[model samples]
Target: MPAGASTGLPLETDRLLLRPWRVSEAAIQRELWTERDPRVPARRRIDADGRPTVADFEEAISAAAVPSSTGLLAVELKADAAVVGYCGLVEGGPETEGEPELAYELLRRFWGLGYATEASWAVIDWARSSGHRRLWATVWAWNVESLRVLAKLGFAEVRSEQHPVHGTNRVTMKRL
Candidate 1:
């Protein structure tokens, strides 16, 4: 099977190309992780700073690129082929079952250009096409920008939950 067959989607947007992670992208991935906000850490199960070495980034990308797994897509710009960030559906359990959780991040320099909304919309469209009846996402209650993006994608605030580690309330949103 191909590397990202588990993801089962080859999605694209107007100015971005969304695809499975690649081993060759280790350097770029490392750079992005290094530059991530110190507070949130990009919402992965693993603690990024504790494992910020090159090898860790490699493993992360490899895991995300694997087929049939809840994975992250490498978002690259069409004009220059630079990896700006990532956006994709994360598999959720009983609390969010049957609804892939949407997530994304962009390099700080690339912010304010509407890339988040663009990439997110692409993922939503893909989910809709794949027969997913609903989609959901959780954001730090204080993250206004992300909430705006989710809202723009038609996700309404469904509820909020406390994160065990993050020590903050996460606002859950859903779209159907």
Candidate 2:
């Protein structure tokens, strides 16, 4: 594992390199936004043509450069350094009070290969060592795979709420 330039902390897993977002990865980021599951909220997913707008890529690049302390970072494949998707923290969740949220996403083809679990476990460890009292994640109930990953990471369901897109959203938390 190598220390991240932005956070001064390592974020590596067995097969993934959790690195900072680079401007050159905009195309892949756009593709990620375009080809994501259709069940996601409209504002986050690409439009009907299944193509992300130019602004989407720009926004992604901008968001990625947010100092790494509070934005999603690129999850690159250690085998070939391909931009598979993203995994890191963000600032919003049901409970705010200084708790950063855990988030991860893989390109559809990359799912079902244990990447999410590996990356999430690393994140939980990082958060715990970084002095966070607790780490949290929000998952749609219908996303059973993600729910299972959260459970495997030692996160317990703290609350549930009706979602506008998905039927329900589960807010899970892990004490660090």
lDDT of each: 0.73, 0.77
Q: What's the TM-score of every candidate structure?
A: 0.80, 0.84
* lDDT of prediction 2: 0.77
The residue-by-residue lDDT of candidate 2 on 1-45, one tens digit each, is: 125543644478779888777777877787777775677778788
- When summed lDDT is taken over every stretch of 10 residues in candidate 1, the lowest stretch is 41-50
Would you give me the overall lDDT of model 1? 0.73
Worst 10 residues of 2 by lDDT: 1-10
Candidate 1 stretches greater than 4 Å from native: 1-9, 41-50, 63-70, 163-167
State the displacement of the C-alpha of residue 59, model 1, in Å, after optimal TM-score superposition. 3.1
